[model samples]
Target: MQESVQHKGVTHFTIVKILRTFSPDEMNEFEKFLHSPFFNNHSTILRLYKELKKFYPLFSDKCLTKEHLFSVANKGKSYDDQLLRKYLSRITKLAEEYLSILQMRTEGIRKDYNVLLQLSRRNIKEIYTRKIKKVEKRFNNFQQFEAEHILHKHFFSALKYELLNKDNQIKPHNELLVDSINNLLDYFLIVSGWLLNEIESHSYTYDTGSKRNAVVAPIDRNMIVEFVENAISNLHSEDKDRMIFLEMVLNDMKLSSPESGFSAYTNLKKLVYGNSHKMSRQILQFYLQRMNVYCLLENLRGTHDMHLDLFQNYRKLLEENLFGSEGKTNLRFLEFRGILISALKIKEFEWAEKFINENVKYVDEDLQANVFHYGYSLLRFYTQDYSESLSHNSKIQSGLLPITIDSYILKAKIFYVLGHSDSALSLADSFRHFINLNKLISDFHKQNLLNFLKYFRAIIRLKAKNNIAKAGKLLAELQTSSNTREKKWLIEMTEDLLKLK
Candidate 1:
C-alpha cells in the first residue's frame, strides 16, 4: 500500500529518526531493552512499539499514521494527539537511555571504577579488595597502553592510596601516595601534549588559507609546548612517557614549519617504530596515521615527494592489523581510500586491486559497491585502461565529497586520455562551477580543486591543438606553481604532451 500523506509527520518524527540509526542487531537489542519491565512497564507503549517496528527503517506505511498508531496503542478509544505525543516522548527518552547503556557497556574500566567507588563508600572491604585485585590483574595482562589504560591506572593507584588511608589500624603508605601522584602527572602530561599538538596543527591548517577567517586560540600554544618539552626532557627516550612527549613535539614540528616537516616526520616515524614493542596497538596506529597526514600535507604543499613513503607506512599498518581498533573489524571508508590512493600514487596496480578486492567487504555494506568501483576506476586509469577505467568510474554515485570529486577528476582524465577533448573540456567547466558553488568544502580545498581544473583544461586544449611550445610553457608554469592539486598527474600529462610530435 502507498504511504498516506497524513503519515508524513509520523515518518519525520524524532523517534523515527532515532530508530533509523539502529542496525538490525541493535534493533533486536532495543526490542529486548523495551521488554524489560524495569525499562518499560506501560502496555500502551509496548503496543505502540509493535506498531512502529512493523515499519522499521522505512516508517512510511499508510498504517503508520498518527491516528492509526493511537488506535493500535490504545484500543477502543478515540484518537488523542497529546496522549500519543506523551507515549512518543517516553519512548524517545527510553531510546536515548538505551544508547547511553550501549555506550556504557563498552567502557569496562569506567564501570569497574564506578563499582569500586561505590564499594569504598559502603566500606565493603572484602569485595572491594577482591575487585581491586581482579582489575589489577586485568591491567597487568593488558598490553595496550592507550589513554584509557593510563587513566585507569591513575584511578586504581589513587584508590589504592585512599583505601590504605581509610584504615586507621594501618599506617598510610607514602610509597602508594607517591605512585598515585606520578601516575596522575603522567596522565596530565600525555593528554596535554596531544591537545597542544592538535592546537598547533589547527593553527597551521586554518591560518594559512588566505580566504579563511582564522580563529585565534585563547591560550598561548608556545607556553604549553615549552612546559611539555621541559617535563619530557627529564625522562629518558626509552621511557614510554618520553616517547609520547617526543611524538607530540614532532607532530607540532611537522605542522609548524613546512621546511622542517619532512625531517620531523622521519624522526616521528622512528620514535613510533622504535618503541612499537613497548607501545600499545592503539598508540602505534595513532602515530602511523599522524605520519601519513604529514606526508599527505607535505606532498600537497608541492614541495616534497612523500607518496611512496606514505604507501610504505600504510603497508606497515596493514601488516600489523592496526587499521581497526579491538573488536572493530570494519575498515573506515577514508582509510580504505587512503590505502588505495597511496598504492595508486606509486602505480602499484596489482597491489591496489588486491587490496580493493580483499578489503571491500570491510567497508560499510551500503558503501561497498561504490567504494570498490572508485578504487578500481583509479587503478584502471593508472594502468592506461581508459575504457575500463571509465566503466568503473561511471558506477560511482554522488556520495562522500572526496570520492565524488575524485571520480569527477578520474572521469575527466579518462576522457582526456582517450582523445575526447571536447567531453573533457565540458566536464572540466561544469566541475569548476561545482567547486565554486560548494559551501561545505573548505576554501583551501576549493582553491586546490579549481587549480586542478584550470591546469586540466589547459592540458586538454593544448594537446588537442598539438601546441608543444605552449604545453612546455604550461608544464613549467605548473612545476613552479604551488597551489595545485593533482600536481603529479598534471605534470605527467604536460610531460606526455611535450613528447607528442
Candidate 2:
C-alpha cells in the first residue's frame, strides 16, 4: 500500500518522503518506536534509522541525535549493560549467551586481555608475541567486516592508551608498556622501511640496436650519517647506566669514518667524566681501551696523539683506583698491559721493560705467553740480544702459543743479524706458510712481511757470496710483488747486498 502525506503546496505519496517531512513531535515518537523491542533486531534497526535520520536532525540539538543513537545502540545490543540486565536477568546468563559464543567463534584468534595486561605489567617477550598475533588476526581474515573494523580500531586505541598512561595499575611496573611499545615500533619501522626500499628499486632493461643498458644510483652517505646521529640521540639515557650499553654504542659509532669516531669518542668521554659514577668510570675505561686497541691494530698514525692522551688519563685512573685498598686489581693489570703495548709501539723500550718486569708476577698464563713472545721478538730485533731472545722464543714456540706474522718477521730478522743463515731461511719459510694458510692478509701487513723476507734472504746471499743466481731470483720476486714502500726498501737492501757481493 502507498502512503500519502500532505505538504503546504504538494502531496507526497512515498513513505520516505512522508517521514522526511514529519514534525518534531512525530519524529520523537518514531525514535521511541525504533528503540523498542519490536525493532531490536539488527536489520530492523538499520532500516528504521536509515529512513528516520533524514528529518530527525530538526528534532534534537545533540550531535548524534536519535538516529545516530539508534545505530550505536543496535551495535551494543548484546553487550550493553541495560539490555543484558533486563533481558538476561543475570550476568552469567549474558556471558553464556554473548561472550561465550564470541569466544568460541574467535578462539585463539584474539589475545586474552587479561594475559596482555599481565605481560605488559612485566614487560615480557610473551606479550610481544601475543600482540603480534592479535595484530595479524585483526588485519587478516574476517567473518564480518564490521567485526574486523571494530577489533582493529579498539585494539590500537587501547594499546596507545596503555602505553601513554603513566599511572601504575600493576605494582612496580612503571614504564614497562612504554619501553615495549618503543621497541616494537622500532622493529616495525626498520623492517618496513627496508622492505619498502627493496620494492621501490626496480631493475629493468630495454634493447636498442644491439645495445646493453645499465642503471645506477650512488649511496647516500648523508642519510646514513643522519640515521646514526638520530639513533644515538634517541637511545634511552637510563640504558647508559649499564656498562654494556656504553660498549655497544661505542662499537657502533666506531664503524663510522675515523674522524667521526674520534669526535664521538671525545663527546662520550666528556659525558662519562662529567658523570663520575662507578659505572660511568668503568664504561669510560672500556671505551678508551677499545678505541686505543683499534687505532693500534689499524696503524692509524694520524690518531696517535689522541690515543696517547686518552691512554694516559685512563692509566692514571686505573692506577689511582688500584692502589686503593678496595680497588679492582684485574683492571689495574689490564691498564698496565695496555700501557706496555703502547710504549712498545712508540719504541719506548725502557718503559716497556720496566712495566712488564714490575707486573710480570700478576700476569696470568695467557698474558705470559703473549708478553714473552712479543717481548722476545722486540728484544732480539731491536736490542740485539741473541741468547736471551732465543730462550724466550723457544719457550713461546714450545708452549704452542699463536704467533703473529710480525713476530715471525722479527724472528727472521734476528736470525739474520746473528749470522744464523739456516735459522733465518727456516723462519722465512715458516712465515711464507703462515701467509699462504691465512689467505685473507691485510694489505698493510702483506707488504711489510714481503719486505722483511726479501731483506732477510738478501743478507743470507751476501754472506754466501756465491749464490748470485738465487739472490737475483729472490730480488726479482720482491720487485714483482712489492708495493711502493716495500719496493723502495727492497731496492736499498739489494744495492747494499750487491755491493757486498
Candidate 3:
C-alpha cells in the first residue's frame, strides 16, 4: 500500500542532487523531455510534478525563487533533473494560462491577438521582400542611423502589441515587453550620437569671417537624404514610431546647419504628409510644432519661398484637421487661432479671413477679440471702413486681459486708421510715457514700438495734410531702421499711402 504523500516545489539542494545523480545519457533524455511538446500542457505538467514528488520524495523545497526556476526550466536538459522538471512545469503552466486567456477572449486578448497576427504578417512581408534589408544596407556608413531605423521598427512592433493588448489583464508581461522595446530605443540613441559626431566632423568646413579660407569636407548629402527617408519610412509604420521619429527629426532639424536645407525640407514634408489624420490629434499637434520651427528658421534666413511653403503646409493642416468635421480639442482650436494670427502678420488676409469665419464660434472671448480687431483693422485701412474698424477695436480693448503696451499700440493704430490724427498722436505719446514708466516692452518690442511710432506719426502727419515733406522724411527714417520682413512690408504700404496723397 502507498502511504499518504505530499509534494513540494524543487529546492536548490534537490536541483543540485538531481544534477549529480543523472548520467550523461539520462540528462540527454531529460533535456528532450523538457523541450518536448508534451510539456506544453499546464495541468498535465503540474500533475506529473505531483506524481513524481509522491514517488521519489526528492523534489520538495520551499525556498526556490521564481527566477531560478525560470532559468532552470528554460535551459535544463534532463527529465531526471528535478530542478529542470520543475521549471518546465512552471513554463507549461504559464503558456497554458496564456492560451486559455487567448481562447476565452478575456481582457480583449482575442482582439489583440487578431491585430498582432496582422502586424506579424506585415512584418514578415517587409522582411521577406527585402524592404528592411535594403534600408539596413543603404546607410552602412552611418551605423547609428541604420540602428535608429531598426529601433523604430522594433518600437512599432511593441506599439502594435500595446494597442492590441491594451486591456489585457496580465500587465506584468506587457510591461516587460514594453521595457525591452524601450531598451532597444536607448541603444539606438547611443548609436545616433555617434553618427551625429561623424556627420559634424565631416561637415565642419565653414568660413569664420577671417582672411584664412577654412575648408572642412562636407558630408555626402545623398547619405543624409537616405537616412532621413529611412526615418520617415519607419515613422509612417505606426503612431508610436511616428511620434518618436518626429521628435528626433525636429530636434535634429533645429540643430542642423543652415546649409542642410534638403534634409530639413525632407523631414518637414514627411512630418506634414505622413500624419494627415484627424483621429489622432497628436499628429496635428506635432505637425504644428514642427511647422513653427521650420517657418521661423526660413524667415530668419530670408528664404521667403521656403517660409511660404511651410506656411502653406500649416494652412492645409488647419483646413483638414481644424475646420473639417473631424476637428475636436480645445488645444487645436487655440493653435488654429495662433496660426491664423501668424498668417495675418504676413498680410495673408484671404487665408486669415477664411480661417476666422470657419472657426469663429469655436474661438474663446479673448481670441475672438483679437481676431475681430485684426480683421477689422485690416479692412478699415484697406477698404476705408474706419468706423466699423474702430467699433471692433473697442470690442478688443474691452475684452483684453489687462491694459498693456500692446493694447496702447492697437489703440494708436485704430486712431490712425480712423483719420483721427490728433487722437493717434496723443495715443502714441501715452505709449512713450507708459514704456518709460513701466519698461514693460521687451527689447524686441521696443524696436517694434519705435517703428510703430514712426509709421503712425507719419500717417498722422499725412492725414492732417501738414508737413508732407516731414512725413516723407519720417517714412525714410522708419524704412531705413526696419529690420524685419513685416516691418518692411508696412514701410512699403506707407510709401503707397504717401503716393496716393
Winner by TM-score = 1
| TM per candidate | 0.79, 0.40, 0.44
Candidate number that wins on TM-score, 1 or 2:
1
Clashing pairs in 2: none
lDDT of 3 by residue, 1-501 (tens): 221111234444334355444455544454445456654544444443333333233444453433334434344442334554555546445444544543465323234434545645665544333433343244243322234344544554465455445435454456547545654754454355345544443332111333355344344334444555555566545556435543454444433456765565566566556545422344344445545555554443334435455566667666555433334534333355446546755567776667666666565645665655655555444444667756665666443322254457656766665567788788888877665564334444455556566666665666566555766776676555532323544566467567765
Query: How much does each candidate deviate from the true structure in C-alpha RMSD?
Result: 4.5, 28.1, 20.9
What local distance difference test score does each model get?
A: 0.79, 0.48, 0.50
Candidate 2: where is the Cα deviation over 4 Å? 1-225, 231-279, 300-328, 331-338, 365-384, 397-401, 404-407, 419-422, 438-501
| lDDT value, residue 486 of candidate 2 | 28
Worst 10 residues of 3 by lDDT: 1-10
Better of 1 and 3 by TM-score: 1
Q: Candidate 2, 498: how far from true, in Å? A: 13
What CA RMSD would candidate 2 show?
28.1
User: Candidate 1 lDDT, tens digit per residue, 1-501?
Assistant: 334543445866889999988888888888888899999998888788878888888887766788889999988998777898999999999999999998999899889999999999999999999999999898878765566777778888888878877876477687766667656765665566566557655544442444356555554545655655666776665776545645555454445455666676777777677667767676677677767777776677677788998898899899888866655567988789889999998888889999999999999899999998888888988888888888988888857888888888888888887788989989898898888777667666677788888899888888878999999999999998875788988999999988886
Candidate 1 runs further than 4 Å off = 1-11, 14-37, 50-61, 168-213, 218-225, 236-256, 274-282, 316-333, 358-373, 394-400, 415-440, 450-483, 497-501
